[model samples]
Structure formats: structure tokens, C-alpha cells
Target: MQHIVTLLIAIVIFGMIIGIHEFGHFIVAKLHKIQVNQFAIGMGPRILHFQKGETEYSLRLFPIGGFCSMEGEDESSDNPNAFEKKAIWRRMTVVLAGAIMNIILGFLLIAVLLCTSQKVPSTVIAQFAQTTDATTGETITAAESERSGLQVGDKIIAIDGSHIFSTTDLIYKLQTTDAKSFSVTVKRDGEKITIDPVTFHNDNTEGLLDFAVQGKSKNPVTVLSYAAKDTVATAKLIWMSLIELVSGKYSLQDLSGPVGTVSVIEQAASTGENVLERVQSVLNLTIFITVNVGVFNLLPIPGLDGSRFVFLLIEAVRRKPIPKEREAMVHFIGMAALFLLMILVTVQDVSRFFQ
Candidate 1:
């Protein structure tokens, strides 16, 4: 029963994300007077569909993907209202709408999560971990961070030159970096201070974080401020991960497909000791996933909206359009390659289940 509930929740959340993304394109196209052929919530064969005023709305079988299919999106057409006939600026707006919607969805979700929390976490160091010395049985400050110059009440501003907006940024910087030490920057005594080569370690734990941060009482302003910062932090994390993947710091095994994502959602749903905690856990994951989707879709990969926008930019510069057939062929090839990669990743995800 729990498994079933988790699955249902995952499906609903995924549907909402995909729906909003497609709706962005659909609404923008409509506003620009472009003809939309279909607005779909999923891919593959249609499970349910209806037509209204020249547009077909569909719920398809595969929840892994969705589309807002504009008329003449992939081919030339004589219709004045076709997507290809749109002004370059209008077309670019339509192309970017999906990613913008995904990002907005992420920000909204983050706000929702913050509203239910007791306090907002800040990047200021509150206290360092303490442990008893074995020989003397006396309490001693054990946090390597503290001994390395991080102090209580100091607000972390950056690590290794990357600005820290929230605790999320602090954690990402600490966990993802391979360096044994870091140049930490903090705001203390109304001035900025840089601590060079600060090393964080623990005797008993393998984790690097050795200090706790203070939390601020939540107010409307703080909630909004923190939510926006966290959203940007999540998006930056996604972008950094993608760059690392391209640089060969990560491999195919590190990538997650729809199945793996659902599995992760299930785990998040089952986390925490209470219902509220579980919901917060799931919401946090959803925020990251939505932001990640937004950032990934904006990458200039063929068959994606970003690539289409690039082509539009070229058309604007040249004062002419690329041949429709050639563009369509390029997208087709890119789509095929993407599908193959998805299949491989899905297989890996399924194999993990058995293992």
C-alpha cells in the first residue's frame, strides 16, 4: 500500500512538472498566434485525448516525457499561423518558455517547502562539534573547521571563490570538491575575511562538514529571500554537475533516467519519522528535480528547445531561415541518439533494482 501511494505521488508530481513545461510553450505560442497541433502530458501512444478549437490535448502512455507540438515546428507549412512563419523574436520566446516555466515551478515549490519550516537555515557558523578526549576525559573542540579559522557567528560567504548564498551552496561546495583544503571566505565584524587552506575532518566520521550553522526565524521577507537563493543554488548545482559530466569527472553510471528518478522519489517519500517530515523531504527532492530539468533543457543540445532558439538566432542574423528539411533531419538524428541513451540508462536503473 505504501509502495502504491509512493508510485501514485511520483506520477502526479512528474505529470505536473511536464504539464507546466508544455503549457509554457503552448500558451506562449497561442499568445503569438501560432497554431499548436497538440499539447501532451506524456509521450508514446495516447491514453486519452480531446480536440478543442484546433488543438488536441493528450495524456499519453509514457510519463517519462511530454511535448507541445506546434504546427510547422519541424516542417514548412503554408499556413500563416504556423510556427515557422512567426517573427524571430516571437519564436525565440516560445522556445524559451518551457525552461522558464520549469524554473518558476522550482521556485514555487521551494517557497512551499519554506512556508512549512520552523526556521530558515543560514550560512553562519553556530557551533563546532565537541568530543571528549580519551586520555583526559575532558571535553575538547573537535571541529577541524573551527581550528582552521572558522568561528562561531561568522557568516560563510564563499568557498574556493564560489559565492555561498545559502547552506545548500555551502554543502555542495564541501561535498563535491576533491581538494583536501579550501580557501574559505566569511563576513565577520562587518568586514570580509579570507581564511586560506582551511581543512575540515573528523576522527569518527568520514564526512567533511564539522560545524553547525545558525537558523533564522522565518518571516515573509526571509522566506521569499531564502527561497529565491535556494532555487538559484539548486540551478547552479545542476549546471556544475553537467559540466563535470562533460569533463569526464562523471560517467554514464552517474546519470539517472526516469526509472531511477522515480525510485529516488519513492525513497524520499518514505523518509522522515512523521508525515510532515516525509512531505518536506519529497518537496525538497522535487525542487531539485524541477530546477535540474530547467537547466538541462536550456543546454544547446540538438532536438531541444535551446538548440531551436540558437537556430532562430542564426536566422535573425542572416535575415533568412534554415531549410526546414535539413533542420528536421538534424532534430530527428538528435532525438534518435537521445532515445538510445535513455534506453541504456533505463536498463541500468532496472538492473539496480534487482541488485
Candidate 2:
């Protein structure tokens, strides 16, 4: 029963995200006087559909993804309002709208979470923990912070010159960094101070940092500021993760598809100390996934919005668009490659469950 409920929830959430994405393109195309032949909420055979004048709205059988099919999107047309006949800038806007909407929705959701939740961590140091050595099991006494020139009430401004707006920013950089020593900048006595050569005793432990961060209060200014910072932090984390993947720091096995994402959502929604905690966990997951989706769509890979923009740039530079047939063929091949990749990742995700 729980599994069924989780699946239902996943479908609803995924449907909404994908529907909003398609709506962005559909609405933008309409604004530009382009003909949208169909606006679909999912892929595969249509379960339900209705034609309202020029556009057909559909609810398809699969919950995987959706699309907005514009007239002359992939071919030449004589109609003035056809996508290919429109101004190049207008077409670019229509193509770019989907990812922009996803990013907007992600930030809006994060704002909601910030206003309602009290779990956000701040940059001010609250206390320090006495960490134990992983190998020796020896408890290190307090004063690591004191000895390292860190003090309570100090506001962490940056780590290794990267601005630290919140604890989320701090943790993301720390976890991904391979440096042995780093510099810390803090605000103390209304003056900026730098502590260099700060070394973390990373004796094969889960966490290297020895300090506990203060939690922010649910105030208007605090919520708004932290919300913006958190959103940027999440986006940066997504960008860094992609870079790491391309650099061979991560493998295909580390990648997750829709199945893996759904499983994560299920786990997050199901595991919490209380009702509010569970809701907050789900909200956090939503923020992460939505932001991730938005950023991924902006990558300059064939069959993506960024790739379309790249072609437009080429058109601008060459004073002529690529041949429609050739462009369509490239996108078709890209789509096939993406389809195969998704299948492989989904299979890996399912196998993890059995293991």
C-alpha cells in the first residue's frame, strides 16, 4: 500500500513538473503567434485529448515526460505563424521557455519551504563536536576550534575564497573538495579576518568538519535571504556534479534515472521524526530535483534546449539556418542516444532494489 501511494505521489509530482515545462513552451509559442498543434502531459498513446480551436490538449498513457508540438517545428511551412516562419529570436524564446519555467518553479518552491520550515542552517558557529579518530577510536578533546582560531559568534564569510552564504554552501564545497588545506574567512568584531592553512583531520570519517552550525529563525528577511542562497547553492551543486561526472570522478553507475529519483522521493517522504519533518524532507527533495532538471536541460547536448540555442547562434553567425532535414536528423539521433541511456540507467536503478 505504501509502495502504491509512493508511486502515485511520484506520478503526480513528475506530471506537474513536466506539464509546467511544456506549458512554458506552449504559452510562449502562442504569444509569438506560432501554431501549437498539440500540448501533451505525457508520452505514448493518448488516454484523453481535446481539441480547442487550433491546439489539441492531451493526457497520454505514460507518466515519463511531455511535449509541446509546434507547427513547422522541424520543417519549413508557408504559414506566417508557423514556428519556422517566425523571427529567430521569437523561436529561441519559445524553445528556452521550458527550462526557464522549471527554474522559476524551483525557486518558488524553495521560497515556500523557507517560509514554512525551521531546519535551515546558518553560517554562524553554534558549537563544536569532539570527534573521535576512526582508526584509533580515541576521543579528541575540545579546543580544535579555539586552536584553529575559530570562535563562537564568528560568522563564516567564505571557505577558500568561495563565498559562504549559509551552512549548505559550506557543506557542498567541503564534501566535493579534494584539498588537504583550505582558508577560512570570517567576520568578527565587525571586521573581516582570514584563517589560512586550516586543516581538517579527515581520518576516514564521514564528516571532516568539527563544528555545529546555528539554525536560522523563521523571520521574513532571514527566510528570503537564505532561500536565495540555498537555491543558488543547489544549482551550483548540480553544476559541480556534472563537471565531476565528465572528469571521470564519477561513473555511469553513480548516475540515477527516474526510477532512482522516485525511490529517493519515497524514502525521503517516508522517513522523518515527525509529520512536519517528513513534509520538510519531501520539500527539500523537490527543490533539489526541480533545480537539477532545470540545469540539466540547459546543457549544450543535442535534443536539449541549450543545443537548440547553439544552432540559433550558428544561424546568426552564418546568416542562414542549418538545413531543416539535417538539423532534424541530428536531434533524432540525439534522442535515440538519450533513450538508450535512460533504459540502461533505469535497469541499474531497478537492480539496486533487488540487491
Candidate 3:
């Protein structure tokens, strides 16, 4: 029964995220006066469909993907309202709108989490951990965090110039950065102060700043500011993760497809000490996956929105569009390769359960 519930939650989450993405394209295309032939909730054979004027809206068999099929989206068309006949700027807007919508949705969800989560941690330094002397292996009662002008009441505003809203924000920036020193900004006694070149004993395995912190009071400005920075941070994290994968820091096994993603959702939905924790777990997963979708779609890979946008960029640069047939062939081949990759990944996901 628990598994069934988890599955339903997974379906709802994915449906909302991807459906909003397709809707972005559909609405933008319609506003630009492009002829949208279909607006589909999924791919493959249509399970349920209906026509409203010229457009056929469909719920397809598969829930893994969807599309907004505008006239001349994949081919040349005689209709002036066809997508290909639109101005380059208009076409670019349509191509990029889906990812933009996903990103917007991610921020909105985070704001919801921030406003509602009672346990959301903050960057304000409630206290500092006693540092240890390296040679003596004894606690240094007076540490550099204070000696360098960091105080107990200081509210961390930024680290290395990136805005810091919560303790998670500070930790994320610190973990991802390689610098031995950072410029830290804090609010002390109602005044903003910058502590430049604050040195850290970075071991690369743990957080840089030595402090015990708590969540800020639910200040509207603070919450909204945190949400904005956290959104940008999440996007950056996704990009860095892809770079790590390409550089062999992460293996293929680290990747997840729909099956593995659902498994994660199951874990989040089930593994909480109480009802509130469980709810927070689900909300966190939703934010992560939606932001990830936005980032993934923005990658300049063939058969993806990013690649289509790139082709448009090329057209803009050359002041002439690429031949539609050749462009379509590129996307077709890319789609085939992507399908093969998905099959392999899905098999791997299933195999993990047995192992």
C-alpha cells in the first residue's frame, strides 16, 4: 500500500513538472500566432485525444515525455502561421520557454518550501564550534572565526560574494569552492561588514566554516532572498555535476533515469520520523527534480530543447536558417541515440534492485 502511494506521488510530481514545461511552449507559440497542431501530455500513441479548433490535445500512452507540436516545427510548411515562418526571435522564445518555465516553477516551489518549513536552517551564526590545534590535537578555545572578526551574533550575508541565505547555502558554496580563503560578509549590530581573506583549514571532505547555526525567523524579505539565491545555487550545482560526470569524477552508475528517480521519491516519501518530515522530504525532492529538469533541458545536446535553441542561434548569427530537412535529420539521429541510452539506463536501474 505504501509503495502504491509512493508511485502515485511520483506520477503527480513528474506530470506537473513536465506538463508545465510543455504548456510553456504551447502558450508561447499560440501567443506568437504560430499554428500549434497538437499539445500532448505524453509521447507515443495517443491514449485519449480531443480537437479544439485546429489543435488536437492528447494524453498519450507514455508519461515519460511530451511535446507541443506546432506546424512546421519539424518540417517546412506553406502556412504563414507555421513555426518556421515566425521571426527568429519569436522562434527562439518558443524553443527556450519550456526550460524557462521549469526554472520558474522550481523557484516558486522553493519559495513555498521556505515559507512553510519550520526547520529551514539559516546562515546566521548562533554559535561557533571550538577549533582544534593541529599539532597539539587539543581544542583551541579562541579560534580564528572570532579572531578574524566573525562574532556569534553575526548574520552571514554572503560568502565569496555569492549571497548566503541559509546554513545550507553557506555549506554548499564552501563545499563547491576550492579557494583556501574567502571574503565573508555578515550583518553585525545592524551594520553590514565584509571580512576579506578569511582563511580556512579546508580538508575537502567537510564544511569549511566552523559554526553551529539555526534557521532564521520567518522574515518575508529574508525568506524571499534565500529562495532566489538557493534557486541559482541549485542550477549551478546541476551544471557542476554534469561537468564532474564528463571528467570521470562520477560514473554512469551515479546517473538516474525514471526508474531510479521514482525509487528516490519512494525513499523520500517513506523515510521520515514524522508526518512533517515526510512532507518536507517530498517537497525537497520536487524542487530538486524540477530544477534538474530545467538544467538538463538547457544543455546543448542534440534532440533536446538546448540543441534546437543552438540551431536558432546559428541561424541568428548567419542571418539565414539551416535547411529544415538537414536540421530534422540531426534531431532524428539524436533522438534515436537518446532512446538507446534511456533503455540502457532503465535496465541498469532495474538491475540495481536485484543487486
Please, what is the TM-score per model?
Answer: 0.95, 0.90, 0.85
> For candidate 3, lDDT tens digit of each residue in 104-177?
89888888888777745666777666757889999664444665668888888888887765555667777776
Model 1 lDDT at residue 347: 98
Give one digit per residue, the lDDT tens place, for model 1 in 203-269. 4585798888888898889888998899899999889989999999999999989889889989999
lDDT of 2 by residue, 291-318 (tens): 8878888888889888888898898889
lDDT of 2 at 307: 87
Highest TM-score: give the candidate number.
Answer: 1
Better model by TM-score, 1 or 3?
1
Best by lDDT: 1
Against the true structure, candidate 2 reaches a TM-score of 0.90
Order candidates by lDDT, high to low. 1, 2, 3
- Candidate 1 lDDT (Cα, whole model)? 0.89
Candidate 3 lDDT (Cα, 0 to 1): 0.83
Candidate that beats the other on lDDT, 1 or 2, i.e. the better one: 1
Ranking the candidates on TM-score from highest down gives: 1, 2, 3
